[model samples]
Target chain A: MGQFFVFIKKEFYHIFRDRWTMIILLILPVIMLTLFGFAITTEVKNTKLGVFDPSKDIATRSIIQRLQANEYFILKKFISNPDRIEDEFQRGEVGLIIVFPEKFYENLLHTGEGQIQLITDGSDPNNAITLTNYATNIVASYQQELNKTAVIPYQIVPEIKLLYNPRLKGAYNFVPGIMGMILMLICAMMTSVAIAREKEKGTMELLLVSPMKPLVVILSKVVPYFFVSIINLATILLLSVYVLEVPVTGSLFWLIIISLIYIFLSLALGILISSLVNSQVVALLISGAVLMMPVLLLSGMIFPVESMPYLLQLLSNAVPARWFIMAIKKLMIKGLDVTSIYKELIILGSMAFFFIVVSLKTFKNRL
Target chain B: MQVIEAENLTKRFGKFTAVDSISFDVKEGEIFGFLGANGAGKTTAMRMLCGLIKPTSGQGIVAGYDIKKQSENVKANIGYMSQRFSIYEDLKVWENLRLFAGIYGIPNRKINDRIDELLKRLGFESEKDTLVKSLPLGWKQKLAFLVAIVHEPKVVFLDEPTGGVDPASRRQFWELIYEATDRGITVFVTTHYMEEAEYCNRVSIMVDGRIEAMDSPRNLKNKFEAESMDEVFHKLARKSTRTGD
Candidate 1:
């Protein structure tokens, strides 16, 4: 244990003395969290919408009012001629256009039905779909209000509620996910690279040939990183809670416990990677390509595993981050207890055990 | 008693043998040199003796520990310096000394005094607090050697420990090795420079994984009928390649 402490002190020196590594370890998490929090969002707001209202009727005006009130669309301009609608959309200024024919109200009064055209720029297919859906629902709601006073026997009523995030705050959803990704990247990749660096410099041979046991050496290398990762975790958590005003509905203790578990798994994975590869570059490539990418993609951080293809879903089972994200979301967002996420806990425990065992085996084999 | 003894020791990576069947013995407190060119199996044999690597088929005893069953025990009793300067670059000179001493389970109170003594002896007292990466290559090499022997192991294995340093630094390094031998610690070293071989009490020349010649430097020169160890090394190298072909 004393030897381990001394070794860990050296590892700390390695991290703190090097300017480049210090910058990477301390600055990267903040930059990544802020960039991902602001840039990547699921909610659509302030989309430019164009109107081609030839009807000049009260009912059509009411539908436009309802669309504007929802905050999903910003009224860019009104085009008198239909020909200019295509050009505005092509210029990328307009995301959607609402067109009502000249006799819209008259037709609705006589035949109880009117045609309203929704011309959307399909270039950004996701936003286009969302804008069209929003416009359709507003028009349906306006018609229902009209039908209440009118003698229309058949009416379609639209009721919409934005659940879970009524204000559509992007930070609330992304901050937790970014926490998991950044922690995993910092903890796993950094530790593995550090170990591989010692090997590359031939320092590891000196350590092994000393009186230090192999387990002590491995533990010492990982212990400093474990503490560094915890500091990063605390930084991210404080940023999300105080700076972003994101809620942690569950117990703070549980969140920390889970994060520590994931950190250990990542560190073990790094040690395993360092054992297999002899160079820092190869270790980085393996950590990023084999570990980080899968965590980012399949961990349900960006893509939901339930909606993914069957093979990808099956492959995601191998990624520890998937389970971590699930547990974090449940704890931070849903306020679930440890008992509520026992299965996720089990998966994390098993993965941590598996990685540690594999790393130890590989270390023994190499020595 | 023999500090190191090997018989028919061989190491094979798949079908390619890195160290062929060779036998040798080193008495306690002797400065034994394992000399060869690159890929001459000098490092392979040293690694086997230090217990960093296992021999595929062979028998050896290091520090009275069986090479087959007590490899870890052998490691515990030996100090090894690889070809590269293996000291931690980001650590201070004293910190590096403290870490190795700690690894050998040296008492904390003893470590401080020992580190101070070593820094003074190595003439690094002025730069003891500077990070090792800031030190010159020669200084780093000397510091690594000092750290390797700080624990006072039974034997120290130096693998090309003087490869890139200047001749003055190399001479200073040999002085340190002799100083350690004077304290009754055996020195098992490998080197490519034939001049350094002269400092060894006994030298073994390896060619293609097998020792072609083993003797004192004077005896080796006389047997090859050469005026210097360099000419003797050339004659043996040329003779071995011709036979291999």
Candidate 2:
């Protein structure tokens, strides 16, 4: 136990002594959380909206006011002619354009129906769709208000309520992903590189010749990295909750339990990678290619796994981050119970066991 | 008593034999020089004796423990230093010493005293808090040697420990080895330098994974009718067919 503590202390000294390593270990998580939370957001806020209100009637003006009322849209322009709407899009000033047809209130009041044309830049399909949806919701709410005052008894209003996250905040979606990514970065990448450094420096040879068991040495190397990942987990949780305003809605206890399992799995993967490779560069490359790419692309962190091709969806099952992100989304956002995430718990737990067993078996006790 | 004894010890990777049926013994407190060409299997044999690798066949005993079955016990009684600088460059000098001493199971109470004594002997008391990366390479190598034997092991294995040192540092390193042997610790060292062989009590020359000559440097020179150990080595190593490691 004393030897183990000494080894862990030496490992910590190695981590803290290097300026860049210390920065990457401690500061990288916060940077990534902030970057993913704010910069790479999917939520379309303050979209520049161009309007062509040809009718300029009271009802049209009221609907326009309703559109510009919320934080999601800001009316940027009022085009005089329909032909100029295309020019406004070409100017790249607005992502969406709402063209209220002539006699808009007349057609709506007398004929009991009106046609409003919504023109959007199709170059960015998703943003175009989101902006259109927000505009449609505003118009629908205006129609519903008109129904409340006037005696329109049979009109339909499809009340859309976004569950779990009502405002569709991107932070809620990425908080779990950032947690998975940050934990994997610290546990898998850092631990493998640390072990490979000992090999590259020829210190592993000296270590193996000592009375200390190789298992103890490996555990000692992993303990410091494990702690770093835990600290990162705390940082990510705190940032997401306090800074980004994405609270942990589910049981924090089960959330922590699952995260601990995922951390163990990542650390085991790091040990397994270190066992196969003998140099720091190779270890880093393998972990980056094998761990980072899958976590980013296949884990449904940034991309929805349901929309991916069938083969990629099948391949995503092998990525451990997929299950972790899923579980975190359920716990942190949906605020579900422990029974809701038993599948993720089992998969992550088994992966941790498998990696630990394989790494121990393949660990080179001899050279 | 023999601190290290190997009889017909061999190691094979796939079909290629690295150390082939080598046999030798080193008495306690003796400086045994293991001389070889680059790919001549000196490291493999040394690793087997140090209990870092298992021999493919035959037997090795280090400090009265079998290399194959009791490797852990063998490790407990032996120390190893490589040509590569093995100490942590990022750690402070005293931290490195304390780490190794603690890992070797030296008592926590005694580790500070051991570090102080070692630093005093090396005249490195002032540099105790200095990072090892800032130190000169010669000092790092010397410090590595001291830390390798910090547990006071029965035998110490040095694999080309003076590979890239200056002549003065190399001479000083030999003095350290002499000092270690005086304390009854067996020194099993491998080197490429022939002049260093003259300082060893017994020297063995290896060619193509087999010991070609084993005796004192004087006996090898007398038998080969050569003026120096370098010439004796050349006469024996010229018959080799092996290439790069």
| Best candidate, DockQ | 2
The best candidate by TM-score is 2
Give the share of true interchain contacts found in each model: 0.85, 0.98
lDDT tens digits, residue span B194-221, model 2: 9999999999999999999999999999
Q: Tell me what TM-score chain A of model 1 achieves.
A: 0.86
Residues A1-367 of candidate 1: C-alpha lDDT, one tens digit per residue = 7888888888888888889788878888888777766666655788888888988888778888888887888888888889887798778888888899987888878776688899887777876766777777778778777878876534454456455554556676677778778878887798889989988988888877776788888888888888878888988888778876677888889889988889989988989998999899999999999988998898888888899999999999988989888898888877878887788899999999998899999987887
Query: Candidate 1, residues B199-222: lDDT per residue as tens digits?
Result: 999999898889999999999999
Give the Cα error of residue B168 in candidate 1, in Å.
2.3
Deviation from truth (RMSD, Å), model 1: 3.6
User: What number of backbone clashes does candidate 2 have, counting pairs of residues 3 or more apart or in separate chains?
Assistant: 0
